[model samples]
Target: MRIVSRRAEAVVFGGRGDVTVSPVDLPEIGHTDVLMETRVSVVSTGTEGWILTDRFHWGGSMPYPLVPGYQKAGVVLEVGAGVDGLAPGDRVFMTTSKVCEPVHAFSGGHISLSQEIQSEVLKLPAEVSDLEAANLVVAQVGYNAASRPRIHGGEVAAVFGDGMIGQMAAQALRARGARVVLCGRRQPRLELARRYSADVVVNVAQHEARWALSGIAPGGVQVIVDTTPSPDMSLYLDVLQPRDGQVVLSGFYPGGLDVDADALQKREVALLTNSGWTCERLDATLDLVARGLLRTTPLITHRFSYHEAPEAWSMIRDRDEDVLGVAFDWTTP
Candidate 1:
């Protein structure tokens, strides 16, 4: 099929802490690519917020006026000639899109229409809705953390952080048959984790984490997953099993990661870091969500129309309200 010039409305990070919705030119659909019209796109609160506020440390300074998300759920509008597995009208999820120069695509995802490579897209199962699949990448981070450590069915696992990633990690650990202890300062998020993900919820603000963890797993936790940006990994040394303990670094540490090598060496703890997503991992996460093993709908606390992009950003950036699983509905106009 012949293609023509097209434009898409995107959420652009103009500069640090500046967000604007502007029209960006979209490249013509190419072979081995799929053109999609977005139905919903969710925010990776930690990652996107860091990038928007210019705190992300990986790539130095992120170029301004760039699209700043990597999670999008959409419907296929057209497919490239070489694309055999996907066709028009299929529900899909995709990563980055190719946008015309001048405006950069820093792993593009939040846009009205996106042209994604075939390899970067995944077809959704009928049981999983767009909203649930919208946050697949973030959910996969949790899955990655839970999947890293080797543990038995009844082993104890402690997850630090009550944010989306933390909650999701707790759920993933539960799905893996571990007794999950979710730790966080927010009561509401901890309550949700208690009901959905965690067997025990620890309000670290009130009581000590080590004290709370001691009652659950006396010997030591089989694995400790830190889902916060700047967590001191050594704080939980005594709580980790001497030889079999595992620690998964699931959050991005822009400031820099400090590990207590001597302390970890004494215990022979396995330290693993997880970021981004793989096609296999994404597929597995979607299946777990589809099968109702990993709950997604319950964690969602806020939703906004696509036009309310600015308002949504305000809520996420300022934390004026307790927010989790924020989604923008493009179909709402």
Candidate 2:
């Protein structure tokens, strides 16, 4: 392998609706860092979308020019001298970056960068392709959503939204043996959800969500996972099982996320939210993938070559109803 200078391409969310491609030079790695050459990276439409407008829940204090992405896979070009279990030529998935200052990278993975071993970085088996490996980050997020609800086998779950996380969460719920019904407003996205997971699909725009939900679980859904960027409970309050329903919010909610006090008091529902993924979740998702149990091919709705990355921002910003996840192909020069 040629020892090329460390130059990386990144998507930077500039302050107040301005975003750009900022390139930075990466010096040699320290004792605990490994330099990664990005192969592909996935864009999180909801959270990064809000960050573009500086409306994310944690966007108030974050500095502008933030590098937004946590889902990526790449080849290890160089490993820290002290690092063990990893080396150059090994393919890995990680969530770290060495971006320039004046950028609050919530967590990095959009392009090539240096990462510490202590981070949630792991080596992938040779059989797992780059696309599937990059997609694991979102899968891990979905796992967190599915696991947090304590979904048990034979239980009924209703996942709101047909975005990437919702799709992955639906699959995770299925892998855990829960019967899942994915509810969304778009027919195209609901159709895509069918291919990934979800034993049942409901188009809320075409029919009454509550009625459709009633047909699936007349007794009321035991758990509901919402992946809408600006999540609200009122839209699906009627479907929540009275007194013991568990609602998990797996996306960023920009607007006020308050429920009807009287209605919630009467139902006594539980509310939970998650935005981070653990290493355990990553390993579990990969294990399922290796076993041919988990599906991610459907979530790859939008893919762009590395040079088309500029257009990629627009694709994600004004995303069509059908787009699930936006990924940048970094194989190009």
Candidate 3:
């Protein structure tokens, strides 16, 4: 039997509003390989959204014609030799890095862990939906972010930015028994933060956020998680308490931060940075989703088809109509 497969991918053509979708030949499945017919994929509202709008600070030298999605959920249409426990028609989570290559060859550049693709492709639990699994990748990042250092019960944690990741961080922190205070400029998003377990939501756009946070916690917050990249890191630094506090930078800020070194020294705050989730943490996140303890379904505010990818990016870029967690619907075959 002949298998004809065409993969439609999104690439940056030139500048903003210039995205091109083209069909690429799908390689045959190798041993230990699984061919997934993608049912749903998530548009990373933070990273990909910024790239689509050309707001990315990586200069124009960054790789163009890049496949702009990292999180995808699909059904296995074909399974390779020696692959056990997974069959055609089984749902699985697809996690890949920015690049991948044949295992034996290993002819690619320096094999960094981030670039190494770990296909911990497991069958999706019966309770999980395609959209939910697609979002699980990001939720894993949030989970790992919260799991780091492990906040104790009754601890005060401040999550910066009420975006998807920030909201997820708030939920994770709350699950760990931390009283989360979500900070963001958008009112609607801040409200969603509260629904996701933020004890208090501060609208930076409306009022002085630092003063508001001080009012919420007179002793200062125990932990401050920055999920939105701001040029001024002082906003987060000011909210921290003296001695034994922590600041987790989960956001991508390409610029330099203007902060008071003296203040950080005086406060004895521990600064930490987290990129994405490790393989182990990803599994833990999946377990949380399977048990229904973590719910990302409510975070999805908009959905679009593969053809509507450009418009989807625009929705995030223009901040159109209070779009929160956007996902691409690939369920239609």
TM-score of each: 0.97, 0.91, 0.86
| Cα lDDT over the full model 1 | 0.88
Candidate 1 lDDT at 194 equals 86
Range of the 10 consecutive residues with the lowest summed lDDT in candidate 1: 316-325
2 against 3, candidate with superior TM-score: 2
RMSD of each: 1.3, 2.7, 5.1
CA deviation > 4 Å runs, candidate 1 = none
TM-score of 3: 0.86
Which residues of candidate 2, in runs, are more than 4 Å off?
A: 1-5, 57-59, 102-104, 260-268
**Steric overlap count per candidate:** 0, 0, 0
| Candidate 3: segments with Cα more than 4 A from true spot | 1-16, 53-60, 97-120
lDDT of 2 by residue, 1-333 (tens): 534446667777667667677775554566777777788888777767766776765635557767777878888888777788888898888876765565556666676564545356778987777788888877878888988876658889999888888988899899888999998887888888887779999988898888888888888889999988666677667777777788898877666577777776678777788877778878988888777676776578888876676687776677678677778888776
- Which structure among the candidates has the greatest TM-score? 1
User: Which candidate should be chosen as best, given lDDT against the real structure?
Assistant: 1
Q: Once model 2 is optimally superposed onto the true structure by TM-score, how far is the C-alpha of residue 114 displaced, in angstroms?
A: 4.3
